[model samples]
Target chain A: MNTFTLGLVVVIYLLLTAYLGYVGFRQTKTSEDYLLGGRTTHPFIMAISYGAAFISTSAIVGFGGVAAVYGMGLIWLTFLNILFGIFIAFIVFGRRTRRLGRRLNAHTFPEFMGKRFGSRGIQTFIAAVIFIAMPLYAAVVLIGGARFIESIFAIDFNVALTFFTVIIAAYVIAGGLKGMMYIDALQGGIMFLCMLFILVMTYVKLGGVMGAHQALENMAELVPEGLRMKGHQGWTSYPAWGSEWWWTLTTGIILGVGIGALAQPQLVVRFMTVKSGRELNRAVLVGGIFILVVTGFIYTAGALSNVFFHRQTGQLAIEAAGGNVDRIIPLFLNSAMPAWFVYLFMLALLSAAMSTLSSQFHTMGSALGHDLLGTLFPKTRTNGMVITRLAVIFGIVVSMVIGYKLPGGIVARGTAIFFGVCAAAFLPAYIGGLFWPRTTATAVKWSIATGIVASLFMLVFMHGSESAPLGICKALFGRDVLVEQFPWMLVDPIIIALPLAGAVLIAVSLLTKHESALDV
Target chain B: MFGINSCGIWLGYLLAVLSVLLCVWYGAKKWNKDDDSAADDNWDSAETQLNENL
Candidate 1:
């Protein structure tokens, strides 16, 4: 509404986040406190914190925009998010990971890998990769948040970007993971309330559920000529079962986000923050309910936006936002909601972005400072906290540059790329290390190496777009590279690469004799 | 206005709430027993390890 009101709301939210960070800082005493909240975080806080970190601006802005363009079929992703991202993640992965982490006394993801496999070198390599790749994902999210601020406040993009980055970095550098999780829990609650309100309001604004569905069904006949030619018949119905649209929906959206959750280093580390399996078990329900509201509401509202905007403006809201799908949700909120609600929604969106951004920055910083450099130069003995703070600053700069320079429309693709790499490079070894007693350290090491090398080589050499990596796609594939041609790459490296990595681990473990000095 | 989608959403929430309540009940029941002797033994071992490290 008014500039002063909006500014006041923003300032108040920032102060609340800073206060939480201060509280976390006060409680933090050792590396354990900074890394894992001293392993005593309450169950409810841990659950919401984990959910908030998992469902970032990426899901709300990026995936929501995609849903607006693609139709309600993307709602399946929300279902998968609750089932896999929350339920399976907590039940299947969280309990075992917490136990193993305590057993190994590992704090960060890279440290977990290193200690599990008994190889300092493997941990260093994993840390280096995380440091290099995660910033791109972080930057894309920063851009999403900044763009919303620009739209609402009429602020410069660069200025908004810098402000968002600096605020998140300050608290994260000060409070570490404990600060990040406390703020995340609060943000998660805001996100749930905002989504509930938005969903109810959207339906009310559209008359009712039946009326909205009827309107969407009727609007299908009026599908644009270009979309019809490309096989989009309507927004009312599912895409043809065997069509390219169906493949993209199933492979690209559903499997990409769903399977990718397993290997997310940020989410995995949340397991280490609790004391026992019971705490993780308790968190499962909270996480599931949080996802059900947050993701379910976002998808529902996004799909309904098609009906609202099309009836009013004779076009989907995404098209109205100049084809930048990520801006669709913000644009809709600006147009549809009351002025005060817009400020509230902005706060929710900021919470979504900052919550995830803080976690990503913290994870990346630890990867660099504690895992990689710490392992490689063991005698350097630099203060770990100082190195981590500097790494956070470095990460912010890298992500900012990438966010500004990368061509737009890449947020969705960039998310797929990062998640795919994680699933491939880490999933096999991580799973085997936990469940399989015979998984040798050598086998684990080679599997990780193979998975990372193969996935990266595919991304750079075979899968890159025409402008990527010196036109290597045209040279190799004899056509401008299509992510669709090798759709497996777009899905997750895990499905293919995990099995391959598993095979290598098994074969190598079988061939090599067990060492007499093995610690385990 | 509360239709199938709302019903589904609420059902999910109820299931989650029930699960959480059960977990809290179970945790409290298990951990609130008179196990101070066992705890003391564990602490003694930890203290010995700390002394060795120092």
Candidate 2:
């Protein structure tokens, strides 16, 4: 746990990561290998890479902090993560995505959509949205990783940010998907083991599994007065239905994170990295267990951290962290975890951050170089790799700038907002394009446009979490939200926008003749 | 259930476990299945036609 030992550990980890990246670089002889891992990736590597990329430090630290405040009600999000994110994603969507990619020769998600719909305009538009909206998500992950580095190394924030960004950038830009997935598999393993230990150790610290839950249940009266008024029952119970807390938990956190997983460009692209349906089918087992352990343990440990904090200092986790939800997990670890484990957990957190960051950066680069720029300038197609590497650097720089400018306490909100937007903007079109041969290119265009506009409008004018800070509604309409009614503002954009997007897509698809030439 | 009184919360936990089991079963059952070629039968021809139209 000494500074020298921690430094040595980090150096060794970085060396391993660099070596993996180099291996990927050495293997890369063609554009296909750089972009899609030659479309023959091992099922285990593909599954773990997907899991690691999907579970970021934001999910662990930010949402875990939220679980500390909200109790085990977050178990629903974990359930949905396994069900929708892994099971349905792999079995239902992954198999078809692989086949479609192979058939269309698509290298990116936007490309897949564009080629499927036989519309260059749709591809450019999807790529444009990804290039524009994804940096905030990437920035938050960068911030999470950089902050951990800052605390562990006791360095300046800017220095940590630079070091973290540069290392991830080096690997992603040089090795591309192949290098990134190898590192992701390694990081995912670290995350899985660390979280498992944390879960068991937390139970041991809290006396036992059932005892911990019972104690938390007994502490229901200890719920803060404000949250109680919002209908918080206990650490072990759901919030009262129709209450503000219930709406936020169910709509904002649960639905947004759950359904949103289906449309993520980075995650969707992973399906294309494998060779066939069989690989995807085989991947479901590892992906399912990996997601369950990583997310399930964090939410469980986070909720139980309340008991640890309360018993140790007669303060709830939220109060002990002085009202900053993001600080609860770190505080709990510093307090309860052994020194050596804390040091080791730093690597796990680093893995979480870097794995997600690498994927986001890769997705952004592909969106730019392969989908947007390549379509806009046909000449750029010849040097697509070079263009993508440059775009990766651009994405990193933009994310770093945004990370420096963003305010605190935005981690969980930022994550949910991005997920909600992606869900509304991409999910309907993605699903329709995948399964419904009746889905027309024109309908997908309208659907995507509707999703983007509706979700943005809701974020700006209706959703209290985003609108309050954005202040666009307040400045224009003299209110924090267009609807001042209770529980309305807490409703996430995805709930309303996704339905609307799907309706538009379906209505348009039904009214128009199916374009058989573009049919899959 | 599991010291948690809320049916919804306990159900959520139980369902999370069961979902993983379902995934495992599904994966094991269909591990060697080769259905992609049939699904992709139209892809090559469709791509050729679409490219010509565009």
- Top lDDT hit: 2
Encode model 1's per-residue lDDT on A1-520: one tens digit a residue: 6989989998899899999999998987777787788988887899899888888787887777776776666666766776677766776777777766776788988898788877787788788888888998998788878887887789899999988888998888889888888999889989999999998899899988777756765667766667565446566455655555665667656786777788889889989998776676667656766877788778768877888898779887767888777778988888888877888888888898888888889888888878876787775335767776777778878888888887655656777778877877788777777776677778777887777776666666544331264466667766544464634333334455656776888888788765311232
User: Chain A in model 1: its TM-score?
Assistant: 0.91
Could you tell me which residue pairs clash in candidate 2?
none
TM-score of each candidate structure, all chains considered together:
0.86, 0.96
Task: Give the per-residue lDDT of model 2 (tens digit) for A109-141.
Answer: 999999998889989999999999999999877
How far off is residue A461 in model 1, in Å?
Answer: 5.3
DockQ result, candidate 2: 0.67
Instruction: Assess each prediction's global lDDT (C-alpha) against the native.
Output: 0.75, 0.90
